[model samples]
Target: MGNMDISLKEMMAIDGAVGAAVVDYNSGMALGVVGGSKDLDLQVAAAGNTEVVRAKMRTMESLGIKDGIEDILITLTNQYHLIRPVSGRGGKGLFLYLALDRNRANLALARHNLRGTEEKLEI
Candidate 1:
């Protein structure tokens, strides 16, 4: 069972990771954050992404899609934003957000690592 600190630390270790946060989507609050610079504000990212998650969930429900979201990826000109909702009982309504430098990050590897981290996370 991994704690938030460990989970966040692991996230930051990912190649090209610039910032990471564990957020409570229900309240749009960040439980923990790490690795943000002057240009990257994790708190703002957390709050803004909460709406993204909610909107997607709503859309899925409205469309009668029963599948759960594994993750959401947003690509920018220079970066990649990844949002992964926690699936464990202890982490309900929580998510892990990661921002990566597109040039340095291997998207497939990052996604795989995030999934492993989530599986071991204990909120």
Candidate 2:
């Protein structure tokens, strides 16, 4: 079982990682954050992304889709934002948000690493 600090550190070690946060989507709160640059406020970004997760969940519900979300990817010209909802053990209403530099990141490997981190994570 990984604690928040350790988990955040591990996430930051990922290739091209610029920032990472563990947020409570239910409350739009960031429980833990790490590695944000001076230009980016990870806490604020985490809160804003909470809305994105909520909106997608609501849309999925309305569409009557029973499948779970694997991850939400937002690609920009120079970066990638990865949002992964946590749903194991006691996890619910929480997610891991990771920001990566597009030039240095391997999308597939990052996703795989994030999944591994999520599985070992413990609130």
Candidate 3:
């Protein structure tokens, strides 16, 4: 079982990974993070992304969809941002935030890898 540290470490192993964080959407806080760029503050990114997650969740509720989120992907010109909520009961209210260079990363593979990582994550 992996905790926040272990999960964050695994996220850093993704290709072209610039940074990764374990964030609490309910509180807009990063419980753990690693390998962030100085130009892009991971803490701020994590907190801001919390709103994205919440908005999507709220929309889902409004639409009357009962299923949980698997992940959220935001693709930009140069970067790919991935937000994946933890699935287990132990990881309630938290998510994994990852950023990668679009040119250097494979989005599909990264998604698959992150899913694997989340499944084993203890926290």
lDDT of 2 by residue, 1-123 (tens): 348888899899999999999999999999999989887799899999999999999999999999999999999999999999997966788999999999999999999999988988888
Give the least accurate 10-residue stretch of model 3, judged by summed lDDT: 1-10
Q: Rate the local accuracy (lDDT) of all candidates.
A: 0.96, 0.93, 0.91
TM-score of each: 0.97, 0.96, 0.95
Best model per lDDT: 1
Best candidate, TM-score: 1
> Between candidates 2 and 3, which one is better according to lDDT?
2
Among all windows of 10 consecutive residues in model 2, the one with the lowest summed lDDT is 1-10
Candidates 1 and 3 compared by TM-score, better number:
1
Q: Model 1, 38-73: lDDT tens per residue?
A: 998999999999999999999999999999899999
In candidate 3, which residue ranges exceed 4 Å CA deviation? none
Instruction: Score candidate 2 by lDDT.
Output: 0.93
Give model 3 RMSD, 1 decimal: 1.5
- Candidate 1 segments exceeding 4 Å error: none
lDDT of candidate 3 at residue 70, scale 0 to 100: 97
